[model samples]
Target chain A: MSYKLQFAELLPYWNVLLQGLIFTIVLTVVSTVAGIAVGTAGASARTFGPVWLGRIVAVYVELIRNTPFIVQLFFIFFGLPALGLKLSETTAAFLAMVINLGAYSTEIIRAGIEAVPKGHIEAGLSLAMTKWEVLRRIVLNQAFRKIYPALSSQIIIVMLGSAVVSQISAEDLTYAANFVASRNFRNFEVYLLAALAYLVLAMLTRSLLRALGRVIFKAR
Target chain B: MLQFSFWDILSNLLIATQWTIVLSLIAFVCGGIVGLALLFMRTSRIPALEWFTKVYIEFFQGTPLLMQLFLFFFGIALFGFEVSPWTAATLALTFWTSAFLTEVWRGCVESIPKGQWEASSSLALSYIEQMRYVILPQASRIAVAPTVGFSVQVIKGTALASIIGFVELTKAGTMLNNATFRPFLVYSLVALIYFCLCFPLSWWAKKIEGRLNVAR
Candidate 1:
């Protein structure tokens, strides 16, 4: 069967594609911010909180890390409604991405925190610096510097994972791709374009994170 | 109200869990085979072959698996080949798995000291002999834990197969939710089963790494 490739068919839907890309980026940015907050808090809880709290954080980390992100998204999107806690598709997707990234980053940040020398904390104590001040001024920044690479990779993984949110009609990049494909019956071309878009997004995200890292960490 | 008894939901989910396991296994085995070959090509000194394999890994790793599954599901059918959900999931996942495993194995192989390769070469070992007798033996020790850890990822990945209509755990949960309207129970049960399947593997991988670290 001779088939001609038709990239022209999708030309009209370029705005939808652009909107989808924006939503995808919006989700990633929101989730990255929320996830880092959740992760830093969880990491500190696991590292320096009371034993019981640490154990609870441990369980949360394991549960999130072990299961699939898509399952977690489904649970939030579908399951929560049953519990009378209704969330929009976009909200559910954002919550799931943050939760997923938070769990993984907890571990990453924990590793970085552990790598901080015990003497550093003792020195802060000897200087009469409150524990919170030490953590804020010294430990947290150093931990962020140390684990920035792993943390960025996890963020990218979550970005790629945002594609699954399309399954629930979240109107992300993949959702728009699906919309255009179903409309034009150009499944192959549409998906091929979607794949390329994701590839470019991944590369762009990596470089952006790397540059961001340089600015934030202020190191070579 | 369509009454799906608690037992009814449990049994249906238990059955669907089997497909999840099956798809993960297929992807793991097939991806391992393909990944090993890719690893060799990437590690080889041939510039063209190395470049080709590097590009292959990046393409597969950089793109999302959901897109790959969609392409295989509909792309093959466009060429007049009837693509079952099972076949499409497995094919895309295998490629996805190979890309990651190749990179993982390369890290292990490269972790071997530079002097080891020089010493083996000076001792008149051929490239193949050196790999078999020297490099592989050392690298396999490092590779085993990560490879098993990666199985959890492979299992979780099979969940996406449901998007294309593969009746895995996630798919089963969605279907049962539709039928029973007990989304909370169905999905909670589904997530629990995944945790059960994946947690032990992750725990084992960590345990192995702990032991290896102590040994090192």
Candidate 2:
């Protein structure tokens, strides 16, 4: 099957594509930070909180982890207004993302938290550190470093997952792809190009995360 | 002013749940076949074949399933071939699902000790024989938890097909919400249906993972 490549015709859409990319990157960064914060809290709850708290964490993690993210997105984008809380489309999309990311991040962080050596916590305690200080300075620091690579991979996954936001018309890269495909009548070529763009974006994200890791955990 | 009614929406919402299950099952089964082929290709000694498989996985993994659906459902039609949204949805998801499942299964396959592969080969077992009698049986155990876990991804992924007019759970919910004008109450039911379908699988996957870790 002979297929024509139309890379040149796509040049005019570069600005739009660039805008979409910027939007995606920003959403990813915001969600990643929020996800980490929520995930860290969830993980800590599961690891050290009381039995009831752990059970609540388990329910949240399991529900989010099992379901398709798009389903979760739709639930938030479409479901919540029935409860008398109405958010704008982009707000719904962004909030859905944070919730979804938070769940997956929770499990990943929990694993890291669990892997923290007990002896290290004891050593910190011996140094007269308060319990909270020991956990923050010793346990969490080691856990974050250990899970840096896993967390980086998860962030990329979240970045890619952000494409679902297009359903709510948030104008991200996938939404832009839909626009280009619709206008240019080059569905295959447009999507193929979009796929390539996503690949480049993921590679860039992975590298950026690694750079962030290097600065944050200079000991590595 | 989308006034929400509880039981009115709940009744129809229950039916949408079935479509989600159907789509997930279809995608998972189709992906397994494609995944197995890709796994075999990865293990092949041919460098080009291996590179092709790698590229295939990376492409699917890197892109969101949403774009792939648009490309397949709309892209094919642009080339003068009419594709049903259902077909496009299935094809795109099957392709995407294969990538992740193959990578997951391949890891399980390769993680089997090298000595076992060598032992089977030294015993004059052909490649297929070695895989069937020695390698695969053990790898099957490792593959189970991850493969089951990956199915949740497939189930989740089917939701993307709703954009192309496939009336799965999310699509149904979208339409219902438009008509009923009660997005929140309608969608919470949708989310609950999805949670019902996915949670058990997630639990089973974790149960297996814990056991696998213990075995290791």
Candidate 3:
């Protein structure tokens, strides 16, 4: 092979790469929080809300789950403008990630919620807790404990999937690699670095999530 | 300027959908073969092979598929070989799918009782013999539903091939949208087509999973 790896050529673009890495982390963190919140709410509604509402949530989950993330991003970024709901590239990417993770986490959290025994809710209610309190204190707490590992995995998946955001010019880590590759014409080196960065990010995200889970679940 | 009727868009997308299906099948089949090899290495008693398989799965699972696609797409070209997007996408998706499938299948294999391995070895069966005759047969039963479930992911993974300039469903949708300036309609149809292709498989996986749980 005549081609030599030119990773050293990428050194000048370290700041660009750093900015992209930070942006990607920012995207992952924001989307993870908002997505899990949406998931928890959706799960609660499905488990306790009216039949019609449950059906609506089910349809939302199925539609999101069945299609690929890039399609959904395209629909939001390019398609939504037709409906007079134009958003900035970053906003569109963030929205897409939140919506995508929201759907999957809704299903994951729902599984946890359903596994919560009826006796636990009854016990909380008998202790003079309101329905909201029972759900918040007993149902969700136990459900989160049961599904924390699955939920954590989903969060990491979403973080990794955030690479697609670069397609819409959202300037995530993959975008940094693309930008640097275009500048230096070192596509292989740039992508290799970016991939390694992503591997590290995924590991960090996993560990952070595990620490957060430990803190939240307490006494685990 | 050329005009596109709704039927025209649908028909074009339908044509492109065939490539998506073909590409997915290739990736899944090739990945399954490689993943099976990895699964054996994972289950093998040799520390070196097991450790290598573990790192392989971790690297593939941890990195983004888009990045992997880019690596394959560009990495091959750098080696003084003329690389087509088809080869790149196929190779990337295959490795990506193999990583995930190996992990999924590993869980199923591990879920088999330890006593089965002990009893098989007590019968003087070789590792290959045990896996081929006894272990795989049982693990595969538990593996079927999840394997089918992962195919939805394989289909979805192929969409990233569009980014590398493979003219599959998503790429076709982009071209049509550019031509027609009807992003909402084109992308919606694109998403609908994917849902159609994927929903049935997921439904079947779920149904099989439910039956498995009931059986257990």
Candidate 4:
């Protein structure tokens, strides 16, 4: 009971922690963009592509969604090197995040696409719009609007899940915390600080995504 | 050099899988009880209790489950308790699971019309009586599908426990990979085993959800 919290012990390592935080943010941003692009393409393929293509996407989604992200990270980081496809820890981590988020967002976006009324697409088609134009102008805008909130939540989940990338020495925020904790032997304080940082990051990411949504949708 | 046959690896992993299942069940059951308590506090119409529950949920939901595990793993040692990874994993996953389940169940409870509550109260039923007799029954029917769905999350969350040196399936996979030096084969098997454990639950949840939607 006499153990006093020594958060100040971690102060000297603030630069390291800050670097990790920025790296994590970079990871989140890059993964969010790439992941959503992949998801959109996957969703479109599932909804509009050939039967074989749709089945391929379905299998990919199911395989990723059912397994844990950490396992996926391990598979990419460790398993792939055996196949002569070696990647840096950071690249592997980023790939895992993108693939993980892509699967979840694919499902979310697919639901939104399916929710778009058939009548609306037909209306767009009758307006002299080609299939691609109708899908781009009419289908996706509304679908993204419907699923933006869920998509935002999944993005944040991926951001938080990025903590595990440290297990492979990716040197993200959690890795920084572990480094500091090891140096100072203040495991409790360092982890407490890191957890609070993550809480703040999650909140900030949530609001930022909300603001982005408002700008994109422009519908209240 | 010790050679581990494929069966040797598979048999060891299957054993470790039991701990993963056990840990998940403990987290789900304990978290359910705690989450139900939080659900009541959140909906109890008391401002302070409601606010406290809100902060509790926000803290757990906002942070990573891995951070929570580290906190529990190292945080307990500060209290002079010789904490095993099992206890830390259980405590951390329980709190994490409770936060999510409370949110899920809160939606279910709130979806019940206010008229149900008013009607129960008008019949001279107490708050607990109303919840027990009327609200929970209705809410639980809607809650079942999502609750089952969330169990997959609980199971996956246990994978992080491996990082803290818990001898669960993921940890065993890592150990076996080191022993066998076949990361591709080992991790693939690990992921496949998890998929086998989880996919059925995910499918069942979707099926139940579909049935509920049809019933509605």
Candidate 5:
């Protein structure tokens, strides 16, 4: 089987790919920030909030963690409309990703939060810090430092998982590949390029997140 | 007008779930075999094989399963063979599963103390015999919980197979949602079914993991 690679066939479609890549990056950025916020908040609730709230958070984490992200995406994108809520494809994609990442990172950050010793909290309390202040300044800072590596990896995982958003026609990188391939009949070439793009994106995101961690946490 | 009651949507979903389970088992079993091979090569002290395995893992883990599925589904056809959705989905998922399981098991093997290998080598045990008698027995015990945990991932991964036109649970949900125009009910039921299948396995994995930690 002699198949020639025709990357040249894709030159006319560079702008399309760029648009898709931008969408992908934007989705990743928005979801990562919002997801981590939800995760951190849920972690604190599980760790320090009322028992019933903890149970509710536990249920949310379990339900999200156990199911497939595509199912969740479809549920939100298609199902929510039935309940009188209509969301754009991009909005649904964003919501699904945030919800998905939030659940997984809840477990990850909760582990970090649990690693904080009781004495640290006690110290913060003894220093005349309010409970909210102690959790924000002391517990959260230490927790983020302890779990940044795992959290960053989870973020990368979510970025990779974002390829499924194209399934709902959000026009992300994978959707661009589909568009170009269908037009040019270069399925193999198109997907290969898109996969490389994703590889580079994953590596770039990991390094960026690492650097961000260094800047924020200020490693001694 | 075509009609699907609650039970109709549910029973159809239950039937499609069979495909999901089957696809997951194929991936897990096939991937376990390939992953075990990769693990041996990775730990065999051979530089070329070790590097190759590492790159293989990174490539799979770094990219999304959806793209991999698309590639294999279309890529294999370039090699002058017909590519069925079943074969494509299974191949992509197997490779993906092998990469992750290899890494997981490699960690388990590496966690074993250095003395075990030395003791076995001093006794003139062949590498295979050493692995069989001294190394793998210990490592397999450590591997059980995580391997089961990874099964949940495999099950979830099968959902991506739907994009390639495999009639799995997620695909079934979409079809039902279209037919009944009851997206909320159909999808919620689908998520619940997945929850039932996966939550127990995840719980078991954590329970065993906790016990293993205590034992250690």
Candidate 6:
């Protein structure tokens, strides 16, 4: 089979590329927020909650971490309907992203939690702070500051992971590239462009997270 | 409702796990060799090689493995080579794993104290001899915990192979779930098997890291 180079053909799809980038950014932000929330709860549960609750949360994180997100996506998309709980494909994808992100983030955040000195916790308690307040005002703040870099790295991973949403056909960047490449018959160039776009996006995410850490953790 | 005989799935999950193991091994073996080359290239004096290595690391580390899988499965087909699902998945996962491993190893190597290199130089060891005898022996210790930690990622990564119709545990679960019309049961079983596979390794990695902390 002979091939044709069509770099010019891809130029017209700039809007789609932009939309794909926005879609990816939106998914990453949503998942990052949701994942952090879930992870914090999971971490708390494992550390301070009732024994049964901690066990359950531990099991949840490990199961999610061990399995592939694609499988979890299919399970939500295809499996849940049989149980009469139908969700939009986007909703299912979003949920899968949150769950997947939560597991990895739990590990990262938990490391931060552990790194907080025991004396810090005692100092907060001695200052008359409630258990919850101490965990919030001292332990977690310090922990987050310390693990911010790893957390940012994980967020970048999740940002690119948004591409997997295409399995359910969420129309993210990679999905759009597949469409453009198939239509233009310039698969190699289209994918190369897509990869470059992703590389740029990842770097941008890293720099943005670094800046955010600087602003939020000014004590550092 | 998606339902099937429970026992049948047990056997299929077991069998499919073998494919997952096989895929992980292929990717690791191939990725290890490629990763070593990338680490060397990144450490080399050649500017072109250094730029190439950075571009490669950024490219792979930036993108999602799913996209990489899709790009490889479909992209390579456009190069006039008909590709099987296994061929596509192996190529993609191996490519992705190498970049991360290279960086991990590079960090381990760099973490070696500068004095060790200096001492080797003072002893009249050539650069190659220094690396083989002094630098590497030390770096290898630093690399252990992280290497084991990364294998968890490599193991989980094999599950993506299922997307291209490579029937690993995840793919098997999907197929079984579809035919049996039992998503929760099937995938729960799928998740359990993976937990069993991964938890031991996770515990081992943590143990090593704990020991490394003590040693340091």
Per-residue error for A167 in candidate 5, Å, reads: 1.2
Query: What's the ranking of the predictions by DockQ, best on top?
Result: 3, 4, 5, 1, 6, 2
The candidate with the higher DockQ, 1 or 3, is 3
lDDT of 4 at A7: 76
lDDT digits (tens) for residues B106-137 of candidate 1: 99999999998999999999888888899999
Model 1 chain B: which ten-residue window has the lowest total lDDT? B1-10
**Model 6 agreement with the true structure over A119-170: per-residue lDDT tens digits:** 9999999999999999899988888988999999989888877777877788
True contacts kept of each: 0.86, 0.74, 0.94, 0.88, 0.93, 0.58
Residue-wise C-alpha lDDT for candidate 1, range A1-220, written one tens digit per residue: 8677798998999999999999999999999999999999999999999999999999999999889988899999989998899999988998999999999999999999999998999999899999999898778978999999999988888899889999889999999999998899998898999899999999999999999988888855
For model 4, the stretches where C-alpha displacement exceeds 4 angstroms are none
Each candidate structure's TM-score, on Cα atoms with residue i matched to residue i, is: 0.98, 0.93, 0.99, 0.99, 0.98, 0.93
Candidate 5's displacement at residue B74, Å, is 0.3
Residue pairs with clashing backbones, model 4: none
Tens-digit lDDT string for candidate 3 (B144-177): 9999999999999999999999999999999999
- Cα distance off (Å), candidate 4, residue B158: 0.4
Q: Which candidate tops lDDT?
A: 3
lDDT (10s digit) by residue, model 2, range A1-220: 4466677877778888778888888899899999899999998889978999999998888888777787777777666666667888788878988898899889998899989988888899999999889878887888899898999998998899898888778888887877876788766777778778889999888888899999999974
Query: Clashes in model 6: which pairs?
Result: B2-B181, B2-B182, B3-B180, B3-B181
lDDT of 4 by residue, B1-216 (tens): 989999999999999999999999999999999999999999899999999999999999999999999999999999899999999999999999999999999999999999999999999998888999999999999999999999999999999999999999999999999888999999999999999999999999999999999998
Candidate 5 lDDT over B76-111, as tens digits, reads 998899999999999999999999999999999999
Return the lDDT, model 2, position B210. Answer: 97
Taking the candidates in order, what DockQ does each have?
0.86, 0.56, 0.91, 0.90, 0.89, 0.57
Return the lDDT, model 5, position B5.
81
Q: Superposing all C-alpha atoms, what RMSD in Å does each candidate have to the true structure?
A: 1.1, 2.6, 0.8, 0.9, 1.2, 2.4
Candidate 2 RMSD to the correct structure: 2.6
- What lDDT score belongs to each candidate, Candidate 1 first? 0.93, 0.84, 0.95, 0.95, 0.94, 0.85
